[model samples]
Target: MLLAAALLAAAALLARGLARIEGELARAAAAGNRPARVEFVVPEGSSARRGVPPRLAELGGGRALLGTPEGELVVLRRDPTSGELELERVYRLERDPERHLRREGAPLHGWFLTDVERERRTALREAWERYQSALAQALEDFGASLPTAEEAAAEVARRGGADRLLALTGPEASALQRRTAAIGLARAGYAGALPALLVLLRDHQRNAGFFARLCALTEELSGLALDPARPAEALAEAEAWLRAHPVRDPYARKGAASAGPVSPPR
Candidate 1:
């Protein structure tokens, strides 16, 4: 009789556990299918309470019923007859934690969405247009040159064209254009253009040494004489510039080594 009683007790416990699991599943299904209102609490220093919706959607799947700039609330519904659960509408709640903290005189660190789609799109479009225009102009000038021009036309075409472009437009014209040409010449190992870039670097009126340094480093890596004159004055000036504003490019160290030790400006 004791053995039979023990077996019965074990079965009863098993049934209870199963029932509890079933109840939890039902609750989860209902929550997924039902509509809910949500409230979001944004952290301090956030530009906008915008990312919550997408993050919630990803976490909850398409079952998210409502989403607001502040937060999202979702409902889970279960079909009584079919024993199936579905997610209903989600409600978004908007609350700015930073604003609240500010009101309460609490310290808050600011947040900025650096990869915002709209801002990225605008930047890309502007860059594309500017570089395209510059490249078109350079090509046109190349076409205008005579078949048998002064100096090696092919070499000039290769090295002098970019320098000419930089001279005409000046380094301050467009950041995108300057960077694009700098990168292109750097990749091609064009050293002849370094002289023009150095001139820009020396020009106090144009604070474009950073761009020039990038170009110079590229040519330097190609085993070219960046400053052929090695004039004491120019060397001094280059050294002074380097001291004031160290070159950040990884390739610059190599350039510096190749150029020899430059004395600081007097």
Candidate 2:
């Protein structure tokens, strides 16, 4: 009798868990189906040779639905007073030839309706991840091109600040490479990477001689002098300066100089 009671309790718990899971899934689905924040959409007309022309149907009460031949359903809801048409939702329908036609009364144009934002966010995330991987690979390549620690120190001692980082060790080369990358990032409008670059600037693993070059690079880009040894304080100061004087993307500016090798601070 105890064993049977215990089994019944286990089953009840299992059922409750399943009910909770179902509720969570339902909530998730509802959230996923929420209306998309649309930018502007231009009508892309289709020729007879190109296939079926695009369809635009009014759902009454200042609400219009546009069915693109490419299986995109856009719901546009206009303001009652202002008459400004705002995009309510964007859904990618499953490929159904019959449903693509103008139907009298249909729940939806297709069987499955996938939210555009979810798909877009997923794709953007994947692309961003790929970009991060590429950036890491580029950094590794830069590091590979550098000389050994002993060689870099000797080179720095001989040439000082005027000398190009020609034969530096891996650690030393990384510092110069990071400086160059940081400069490039600043020029390219990747201000988000500033913190990472600042961390790299103060890394103890890098040769001490490379700090001046890194500091010089930051000063050149941001007009804020960074003490290479005290990266934490330097980063805070740099951040404050950046908040006041934002780094504008030179590339985006008209008649800006083309990107090239970033020279270290002399």
Please, what is the TM-score per model? 0.24, 0.33
Where does candidate 1 stray beyond 4 Å?
1-32, 49-61, 65-130, 141-266
| Top model number, TM-score | 2
User: Model 1's lDDT to the true fold?
Assistant: 0.38
- Write down the lDDT of every candidate, Cα atoms only: 0.38, 0.46
Show the colliding residue pairs in model 2: 147-168, 147-169, 148-169
Q: lDDT tens digits, residues 172-266, model 1? A: 65533343343333333343334334443444223334434433453453333344233344445554544554433322212121322111112
Which window of ten consecutive residues has the lowest lDDT sum in model 1? 257-266
- How many Å off is the CA of 171 in candidate 2? 24
Query: Residue 243 error for model 2, in Å?
Result: 28
